[model samples]
Target: MIQWIIPLAFICAGIIAGLIGEKVIFKKLKTFVTEKEVPGSDIIFQALHRMTFVWFVLAGFFWAILGSPVRPDIANAFQKILTIIFLYSVTLVLARLTSGFVNLLVRRTEGVPTSLLSNLAKIAVLILGTLILLQTVGVQITPIVTTLGIGGLAVGLALQDTLANLFSGFYLVISQQVRTGDYVKLDDGNQGYITDINWRNTTIREISNNVIIVPNSKLASAIFTNYHLPAKEITLTLNVGVSYDSDLELVERVTVEVAKEVMQEIAPELIANEPYMRFHTFNDFSIDYTLYMRVSEFFDQRIGKHLLVKKLHKRYHQEGIQIPFPIRDINLHGN
Candidate 1:
């Protein structure tokens, strides 16, 4: 009983210290960092949050183990266990820090995807930590390394498709072709916004609120149009025809004015380039031409076309511009 007293006292002291540190010191530090708006403070706080209490408690246990008058072998085993636990906790912290930094870097660049890169960073840290842990525990690592090397080859051969997708995902990210958040239409007619690129597949969220899971290999090889690339603002073409009796100059002017109105509503910043039309055909009843307008993005084209058509129809009616219906002459021959 006397021998246990010191250990118990140490444990109690540790618990009290952990409570005070967490509730007082950590709370003040968190408040200070938040108020200051320090860069990387969030990441540091996240890595350390709730972990400081565990550290203090672990310290108490370590001291208790050291001071206890227990059997030599038992004390040694306890020490080894504590050491392993502490090392693993350190490893976890490192992994979080690495992942946090990776995500921060990607966000700043605004080009690459975050999930896959952050996951890879965390995995790398964890793997290195595991190797260090095994070495610290006096485990033989040479044989394990050799076995993994051989087994990896076998696994690679077995998982060809999986590896292909994984590599393809990397290529897509590094090449900056198919990025997250870009609106893309695949050659197969599936169109959506790229939500994420993961280890095996790319996730696309369609406007219909449905998700499309495209395998990385297929997406990499497919011919897809990225409306987000070359710029988000895109050119929208609306073809209209006027009656042959209508004024051609007035037609172009009115069409352009209507296009400018729609463009102003949809993308006012892009109003520098005035809308224009080209008369392309002399049809049987009406002259056909295409109206070229600019909109902010691919999806905006829909609303843009809708507004242009409605407003043009109204304005044309007000101006007495006749949009003639298609008239085909029927020859009645007794055959």
Candidate 2:
């Protein structure tokens, strides 16, 4: 009972001293570190504070027990337990530091996804820590290694599609084919701007404001168009029909002028040079013509075309040019 009392007193004193030191000393240290703008200094200070507390407790225990006529076996067991605890604390600190370092490195690089890199770093650290813990416990790793290999194989076979998508997602990021914020159109008729590219799927926001999740496997397999890359310019065409009696040259000129004015009115930055109207096809009831123009962005292409058509309609009315509606000729013979 006397021996236990000394050890308990030492532990209590160490705890009180640690609490006072952390509150008084380390709090000031934190302010200095923050003022210096040193990266990951807060984590370093936290780890140091914990280690100092641990050291104080260990020192107190050793001082209290060293003079006692303790059993050699009991002393060795206690030492081993203490060593294991210390190693585990060190491992935790190392893992945290490594994670912070990897995150910093990831931020410095361009086009690398931080989420994926951070996850990988964390997993690597956890695996290393697990191995260390197993070794510390005197457990043979041969059986564990064999079991993991077999289990991994089973999992691979069972989750082939999921794995494919995961790998495909990585490839997509590395290949730089489609990145976040790019407008894309898939073969399945899904068109949207990419919001996030994750390990399993890419999230897109459609023009209608609905979110679409596309699996990486499907994105890899399908033919898709990225409007941002290669070029930002998109060509827009407007098809119009007029009465055959309308003068072809006059109609073409009027349509081109209308397109130019519409582009200037709605999207002056999108307009590329001037528009051209071609008398394309002679339809059953009207002369079909096409107006071609270029816009700065794919999103504006549709709206600009619509505005051009509206302007053309108004202009044609002012010019007294007739836009013919569809006319079907039906003949019936009775015998």
Candidate 3:
């Protein structure tokens, strides 16, 4: 019991000191620094917390080794304490540096790249820490490294498709072919605006406000149309039919004028150029005409087309132009 007393006292003292430090020292430090408008109070708090952990670890180490057969001399004990403190200091510095590095990388890139870089940094730090701990515990890591290499090869082979998608996601970010907020049409006929590009998939928000998650593997392999790239301007064509009795020149002039007017009224900024009406085909019921116009954006085409059609209907009715309806004539032979 007497032998255990010194060790127990050391531990009790450390705990009491830590409590006091947290309550008194830390509080005073916070107040002083805050009153002075210091810039790094948060960092100081983090360092203090780390130092408290160091003290606790050191106290336990001393308690465990005090009565051992290999008990160190006073000078040796002091040296050992210094070494422990040094190691703790080194670890703290390394941790802070690694954290700063991760934050810097995260701030520099966005989307998939930032995620990848941050994850990679964390994994590297963990691996380095494990290696250092192993070495400290007198374990040789050569065999472990070799085994990990072999295991990694097998894992890579097993997860080839997954890795491919990951790499493809990175490629997409680097190439800037598609990004959030771009309107895209997938090969599978899904059309939507890109909401997010993540590690494994891209999220798309449809015009109906439904969200769709598309795997990077499928996106990388599929042919997709990005409507927001190259330019936002797009050509939209509306097919209309008028009765054959309507004058061709009058039809073209009225259609063009109506389209331009509607575009100007609804979306004045969307009209990239003057609208034109073209005679496309002669159908069974009426003459098919195409109204071609350039809009500032693909989405505007929908609204522009709707408004133009409504205006065209009103104008055609006012001008007495007949929009022919399909009719089938049947002749029955009397038996």
Among the numbered candidates, top TM-score falls to: 1
Misplaced by over 4 Å in model 2 are 1-151, 265-267, 327-335
Worst-scoring 10-residue span by lDDT in model 3: 110-119
Task: Give the candidates in order of lDDT, highest first.
Answer: 1, 2, 3
Q: Give TM per candidate.
A: 0.91, 0.59, 0.58
> Lowest summed lDDT over 10 consecutive residues: which window, candidate 1?
106-115
Ranking by TM-score: 1, 2, 3
Q: Write the per-residue lDDT of candidate 1 for residues 279-321, one digit (tens) a residue.
A: 9999988999999988888999899998988999999999999
What TM-score, to 2 decimals, does candidate 1 have?
0.91
lDDT of 2 at 161: 89
* Candidate 2 residue-wise lDDT at 164: 93
lDDT of 2: 0.77
Q: What does candidate 2's lDDT look like per residue over 1-335, in tens digits? A: 77677777876787777776677767887898899999879757754657667766766666556544588788777766766777776777777677666656644553334354455566678778877877887888889989999999999999998899889888887787887667899988999988767768889899999999889889988899999787667678878889988988889888888888877875688666677878878898899988888777778887887788678888889988999987688999999
